[model samples]
Target chain A: MRKLKAVKITQAIVELVKRANFSLRKDVLFALRKAYGFEKNRRAKTILKAILDNAAYAQKENLAICQDTGMPVVFVQLGQDLKISGNLKAAINSGIESGYKKYSLRNSICKDPLLRGKSGFSPCIIHMDIVSGNKITLTLLPKGFGCENKSQLKMFKPTSSLEEIKSFIIDAVKSAGADACPPYVIGVGIGGSADYASLLAKKALLKKIKLQRGLSPKGTVPGLERELLFEINNLNIGPLGLGGRATALAVNIQTYPTHIAGLPVAVNISCHALRSAEIVL
Target chain B: MKRIYTPLDLNKIKSLKAGQEVFLSGTIYTARDQAHKRLVQAIKSRQTLPFELRDAVIYYCGPTQTPQGKVIGSCGPTTSSRMDAFSGFILAQGLRGMIGKGSRGLGVKEAIKKYKGIYFITYAGCGALLSKYVKSVKKVAYGDLGPEAILKLEVENFPLIVAIDVNGGSVYG
Candidate 1:
């Protein structure tokens, strides 16, 4: 068994947190910039421009791209052949605590939710996946409150159709309105138990920005992603839903086989400032 | 329709049109759930407010830390509806405007119409990208709330859109 160095993992995580807070992914940035060119609404164009400018300002000043630096969500992809030499959870949390403290990131975690009292450090929201390779992949997403507030999961009749799936996404966005932020990225998981659906939905947001083999180009991704994107954006929810044109930037869906009696779905919305990063060790 | 700033009066707010984009400027207040509740409670009890509430624009934000000697952290709008139940009383107390993201409750719309106030929506999740507009900041009250405290900030050309007008026109459902 290959020995894993706790020192390397911890150090990399701390750096990941800092880097993720200050930077938006290049692919996402390019998408936003391109969206500006395609968006015909004048207000939307200006809004997109402002979003681009904000990205620049965030980078130049070494500041979080959004005021809500969010809870440090960590995704660990471990190798089945390797060994983690130390307390993995503790090290990740330590990295989170140190990252927040070092970067002056806001401590958004609370004791019981209802804003009763403060929870000093954000607990690491971690998910571990064992893969066949010998490397460990760590990804960080500082999920802000706005997007998190709008996340939803529902179990439907096993016979539900595509329209019903559409309703769940629409309702989730309408209720979320400008709260979850607009020109958002929606992650949807269908056909799992509620929690599992939500888990997969969250994981969907961490996937590569490009369409892949999992969703066949012609029949799967472009078909569903564009169709849903068209409808959601046309909701006229627009930038901030103060009304314009661009509402949702994209919708990514992933489904799992589930019990025959029900169809479960979850939506995890990612706001315009989708700040996340990943690295393999 | 135009975006106005804090320390403003009802007259300026009333002049704003529905569905107009306003560029916010001047001083603004930071207050979330806790601070809002406290402000409303103080009003009922005839207690002194941390700051005066006349034609003032309250920003719904909880900023991050600025370790490198700065006035404030990443200050952006929180969910507006979270402060919905408390908005009526605050509006009746001569408040002119509220800035946040998302839809406000029906009560808030009614109150806005009754009191001739407006709700403004800023870009959500654009906090780090929006803090550049802050020229100065003053910690007024509720420091204990950590990021949820009441702060006074001076902004220039802060971006916003009028979501609910004095006439009760809602941009979002």
Candidate 2:
């Protein structure tokens, strides 16, 4: 078994928090630029330009990309063969707290949901998977609530048609409109139970936004993502819902096996500033 | 782009139309979810507000902590829709204008039309870029709320696009 110190994990998480907040991912940037080129409306084009410029400025100045540094969500792929010497959860939380303090990042986590009080930095949400390798991989996604609040979950009957599912996805983006910010990245999770479906939807956002020109895998409905993308853009929500062709930068779907009785679907939308960073140790 | 200043003139605001880009200068107050609640409470209770309400432009924002040698941190507009429930009351208090991103509710639109108020939208999620416009910031009230505290900001050439006009016309349409 490979031995790793818990403090080292803490150190890595601190760095990850800073990187995720300050830098917009390159693939997302590429998608935005591509959308900008394809956009015809003058207002939409200008909004896209401002978004791109903001990303650049954030990276150069080492500033949080948005005032909403967002809720810290850490995804850990822990190696089954690795042995840890210190408390894992504490290390991660302390790392986040220290990083936010040191970098002057916004403390967005409330102590309680309903009885909300002063916000502090700590107790980051973590999802872990024990994998085969000896190295641990940590990915941090600071999800902004503007977009997160617009997330949707529907338990469709197993007999539902493909068009019905597609409509639900499209309507999710349409209803989100300009409130969640636009040119969103739509992530769809098409299976599993209720909570798991939502988790899958959020996890799907970690995937890179790339331009692909073909069908999805064999079992799933082919061209579902492409068709949904087309329908969503046609809604004309545009960059900031002002008007244009690039309402969604991409639509990513992840599927899982489930019981025969039901079909669960979840949609997680990310604003133009979709930010995440990952590190392996 | 049209240039406007704080303590906005009603005539100037009336002349503006939805979707018209403008550069705003002068003083504004930053207030988000909690601060708005407190302001509305103060109005109902007949208590004095931290700043005068007449002709003031309130920005829907909760800025990040100020870094060393910086007037403000990443300061950007938040979603306007969240404040819709309190807007009619706030507008009724002789407020002139608001700066935020996204659309407003129908009641808020009706209030804007009735009260002759203006709604402006800056770049959404462009906090770093938007902070460049802020010349200075001072915490005026609600120190306990941290980022949700009310802040007085002096801004220069703050870029904005009129989203809702005094006529109830909306760029969102």
Number of the predicted model whose lDDT against the real structure is largest: 2
Model 1, global lDDT: 0.82
The residue-by-residue lDDT of candidate 1 on B12-46, one tens digit each, is 77767666888989988989988998899999999
lDDT of each: 0.82, 0.90
Per-model TM-score on C-alpha atoms = 0.93, 0.98
Query: What's the lDDT for residue A62 in model 1?
Result: 77
Which run of 10 residues does model 1 chain A get worst, by summed lDDT?
A210-219
lDDT per residue as tens, model 2, A1-281? 99999999999999998899999998999999999998999889999999999999988888889999888999999999999889998988989999888888887788998977898886899998999979999999999889998999999999998889998998899889988889999989988999989998999899887686666663353377777887888988887679899899988888898779999999999998999999999
Cα lDDT for residue B139, candidate 2? 93
DockQ of each: 0.73, 0.83
lDDT tens digits, residue span A1-42, model 1? 787878678888889988898888887787787678778888
- Model 1, which residues run further than 4 Å from truth? A211-222, B1-6
